[model samples]
Target: MYTIFHAVFGYFFMLLAVRVLVRRPGGQLTPFEFVIIFLIGGIAILSTIGHDPSVTNCTCAVIAVGMVHRFVAMARTRWRRLGRWMDGLPLVLLRDGQWQLDAMEGMRIEPDDVMAAAREQGLTSFSDVKYAVVERTGSISIIKR
Candidate 1:
């Protein structure tokens, strides 16, 4: 009874926090990002499971959360606006050696981050960068001139 209710409510809160806070994909997790991820999981566990520590309660919560994620994914495909809102549009941070400072600040990105991405793509300098985009997945993509 209360177990089922806790599962649904706890899962919903965890899911909402994830959507709002986590910006990068798994592969791109920096040390700071990794810490944040672990902290979020720890807190979510304390929150979602409460003090039960029962396998049945945990499994129910997992299943409920998984189903909600699946539904959101399916709906995202069917509704473009919802998709855009859930996952923001990509932002261009640099173009032709010029910086889009406002966009970088809005995304909490710095020039050095873009330069590091450009370096990954074998670009030596900003002059060689045709464009730098912060993709919706939170990875920087650099286009070379």
Candidate 2:
């Protein structure tokens, strides 16, 4: 019973921590961010399971965490606002050949990042790009003119 509560609390705590700390997508995570993620996961597991080495406790903890995750997923689907808040909305970083400075600053994105995405799309210059968006997944998307 206490294992279930601990697992639930740990799950939400990790979710909130990751949402606040990680801005880039998994594919783009730097080594530093990867270390942070691993450390957080380790801490969450230790805190959730405590000193219990019993198979029963481990099984219960796993099930509790899974159920909590499933519930959150379902709730997000049913609530648009919750989904938006948890996952975030797509942000425009560039528009009509101009940088959206405010949006870029808020997202901690620089022009170089946008240009790198553009270069990935075979664009050599911003003048050839019409728009750049930071997708909900933290991927930069470039629309070329």
Candidate 3:
């Protein structure tokens, strides 16, 4: 009986909890977006495994983290200061139609990786790459110079 009760409440509240907490409410998630996802997963596990100490405790923790995440996300969008910290600064991978060999070595990314991303955008030759950048999203974007 207790197990069933917790299951129903857990499922229901988690649904309502996520709905009320996230921004862009019902939308897709990106790779970096998975960080918050894992965070909520931990909260869910805590709320369900030992719901005895009160599900309220886990619920409150989830609400608090969600609020903080929402607040940070909003501030990041409004202010460059916050955005840069969370998303990281962009890096240049190519310059003047040439690969920045030193930069690539430093970042530990290889030529093949750059070529792969470039190929996805119709670039088959190195000379065609005007600028290749590792954007804050962890994706490489290339410009044909």
Candidate 4:
């Protein structure tokens, strides 16, 4: 029915919006980012259900959305390019103690962020780090020298 169509559309729309809006992974989301996500999800749910308050309509919408999500996940797995497009490749923030300024800027990362990650890995000095990468999952990885 219309609910199913709305659910599929809303799912894709939200998927695209979240991919564009959220650069960091779920664990690293800021409070403001979390608020944004919640608000967006609420809006998507409202729009998808439209004026339907019936349990059947709600159940159907949920199932449609879940099936669409599962299909996309499977498609991404089968198609490497789709997976790469959905989840970007890892970025090198630092290599051999040298900062990749352009990559850092593009990713909105800073030396302090890299240093914080290094600190978490028990690296006190920049010289003690050999590589720093912004993983596709939006986690900063530090490699010791």
Candidate 5:
């Protein structure tokens, strides 16, 4: 029972934490980011299993977490509003060679990141960018003029 409870709570806690802490949409995870994620997984396991090292307890906890994940994914697909609430809507960082400073600031996106996306898209400068949006997945999408 304790393992099940922890599994459910940990799932939601990590969900919220990720939404708050991670801003880069689809950006490659830095080594530090990767370590943090790995540590979180380890902590979640410890919390969910507690002192119980039994296979049954661990198995039940894993199942509970997996089920909740599947339910959330299904709910997001079925309900657009829920999906938007969970994942957030994409924000326009640049449009028509003009920077949307407020939006960029809100998302903590740096100019270099936007410029990198533009360069990847074969744009020499923001002047050649029709649109640059921070996608929900945390990666920049650049549309060239």
Candidate 6:
């Protein structure tokens, strides 16, 4: 029963970390967002199935980060400028049917990634994507030209 208790709590709370902390924040990914996921995964594993680090320790850390995430989300929404700092606004990968190779390189996304996204949308040529945005959530958002 005790084992089940820890496992359930950690599992559900991890969902909160993903939902409220990550998606609800901005539906986008920034470097900070990546870090939060990496840390949460490490803590979740140790707490869910390991004993060296107690479940309470993991829960506490998760709660703390969750609170901060929520605060940032609220702040970003309330203040437009702050939100931009906390959550990166979308970047244009293509404009007027032209690829922005420099932006793609800076964002560390290869051309193939864009092509794959395009193919998913039935776009066989570059001109089909009017604007491709690499969202703050580290996901790609494509708008067909």
Clash count, one per candidate: 0, 0, 0, 0, 7, 5
Which runs in model 5 stand beyond 4 Å of their true positions? none
TM-score of 2: 0.93
- lDDT digits (tens) for residues 1-145 of candidate 1: 4655666676667557765776674536888878877887787667678888788887877787788778889999999999887878898999877889888888888888888898899888889989999888888999888
The Cα error of candidate 3 at residue 33, in Å, is 13
lDDT of 6 by residue, 16-101 (tens): 56654643234445687778888987887666556645666666555655665677678778999976654556777777767788
TM-scores, each model vs. reference? 0.87, 0.93, 0.58, 0.92, 0.92, 0.57
lDDT of 2 at 29: 81
Compared to the true structure, candidate 6 yields what TM-score? 0.57
Which candidate tops TM-score? 2
lDDT (10s digit) by residue, model 2, range 6-68: 999998888889878867746478787889999999988888888886899999999999898
Ranking by TM-score: 2, 4, 5, 1, 3, 6
Per-candidate local distance difference test: 0.80, 0.88, 0.66, 0.88, 0.87, 0.69
**lDDT at position 37, candidate 3:** 60
* Model 4 Cα lDDT, one tens digit per residue, 1-145: 9999999999888878987776684747879788989999999888888888899999999899999999999999999999887878889999986899999988888799899899999989899999999888888999899
Q: Higher lDDT: candidate 4 or 5?
A: 4
Clashing pairs in 1: none
CA deviation > 4 Å runs, candidate 2 = none
What does the lDDT read for residue 120 in candidate 3? 90
Task: Give the per-residue lDDT of model 5 (tens digit) for 54-106.
Answer: 99998999899999999999999999999998999999999876889999889
Off by over 4 Å in 3: 1-54
